[model samples]
Target: MKAMVTTGARQMVVREVECPRPASGQVQVKLEYCGICGSDVHYYKDGKVGDHVLDHDIVLGHEVAGMVSEVGEGVTDLKVGDRVALEPGIACGKCIFCKSGHYNLCREMKFFADPPTPGALQEYVVHPADLCFKLPENVSSMEGALVEPLSVGLHAAGTGDVKLGQNVLILGTGCIGLVTLLACKARGAAKIVVVDLYDKRLEFAKKLGATHVINAKKEDVKKRVDEIFNGEGADVVLETAGSVITIAQTPFLTKAGGTIVIVGQSAQSEVSYNFSEVIVKELTIKSIFRYRNSYPVAIAAISSGAIDVKQIVTHEFSFEDSKMGFDTVIEDAENVVKAVIKF
Candidate 1:
């Protein structure tokens, strides 16, 4: 089997590696497609994201979908020839977080492409049978690969408690932001205002049902949101840009008693935030750490035609040109919303 390995910053190579066999309660999948996430881009360009630094060569991909080649001992429900989307994070079932169903916060989480754990960028990957969700007959492999990010969007909306007739503010137009918009619409948000510096992404967002698109470079985001909400601000604010500026602006952009969900993981650890306004307004601040128990819901939404997850894919690359896919994402930041590796 061939795997795309990142040796250092801005370095990647396709190298032959031994194919993995699934242990008990696991399954071996021949990967068909894998989406390159923003975290993957950060790890490729800087060799680190916050404290999770890439100390050694590792495969970089987590959004994955493929066909089951073989099922390990003790595995039931799923069998050979089943197409499935894999939930990347594996948690310690014995931990309190896992027992309580908040496994995304488990202390010992082995997430794909997160430095130590090898990802599905390779030709084949072995994952827990329980984590490999079967794809509906109507969903394609590429669409299946998108379920991971869609799950993140679902979790963000759920955390923010987005509801009907609420004004939703999204701070970015990237893949995650667009998916979050879809989730909000599915949840019956009346007005969705998406903010981004890129006009191309903003245009795409508009086509995908964004009620309004604001270019942060040309317009004042706070003023625009104020105008839309008649100075009351948005009911739900989701910060997906991971920018220090946008994260800090959440307090001002959110309405009194509104909820703000931080969906993006910032590269910087600390940001000077305005605590006085947050306290005075009585706003609720929440954050998402990957996602838990969201993959199934995302799949169901896509299957039911409630969400169009694949339209966010603006680029694709063959497994042999996987490095080029990463390069396209890095260099073409404005145009390439999402890039997928086709195996």
Candidate 2:
């Protein structure tokens, strides 16, 4: 088996590695596709995201979908040749967070592509059987790979309590931001406004059903939002850029009683926000970690045509050329919204 390993900043190599076999209650998947996430690119180019530093080489991918090739002992739910998408995080079931069903925040979790844990960028990966969700007949492997990010969007929307007839505003039109847009639309948002500095991404958002697209580099974002909602700010504001500027501006952009969801993780741990404004308006501030129990919902939505995950994919590369894929994503940020590696 071959795995794409990141040795250092802006460095990636494909090297042969031992293929892993399924352990008890686990299943080995011959991975078919893996999506390149913003966190993956951050680790590749910066060698670290916040405190999670890459001290040694590690495989970089988590949004994965493949077919089961072998099943380990006691794994009766899945068998060989079952098409599945891995949820990527394994938590200790004994923890309070897991016991309470907020396992995404478990104190001890082994998440793929997060430095120490080897990711699914290789030809084969062994994952716990329960974490692998079966894809519906109408969903393709590529769309299955997209389920991870869609789950993040779902979590963000759910956290904000998005509802029909509510005006939603999403900052940043990256993959996560676009998926947030899809999730809002699926939940019957009255109108969605997407803001980004890139024109290509704003265009993509419009095609994905955003009622209004604002180029932050050119348009006055605050004025546009006010105009769209007739002086009242958006009913729900989602900050997906993870930038200090965008996160700090949420209070001004959201309605007095609206909710603000922080979906993206910033490189800096802390940023100054207008707490006084939030207190005065009585706004609800919510934040999401990765996700919990969202893969099944995302899969069902894509399968039923309620969400079109594949439309966000703009580039594809073979597994052998995985390094090129990462390089292209970093160098061509304006054009490549999302890239996937096929095995």
Off by over 4 Å in 2: none
TM-scores of all candidate predictions against the true structure = 0.98, 0.98
Clashes of each: 0, 0
* Minimal lDDT window, size 10, model 1: 263-272
The C-alpha RMSD in Å for every predicted model, in order, reads 1.0, 1.0
Model 1 backbone overlap count: 0
Q: What residue pairs clash in candidate 2, if any at all?
A: none
Runs off by more than 4 Å, candidate 1? none
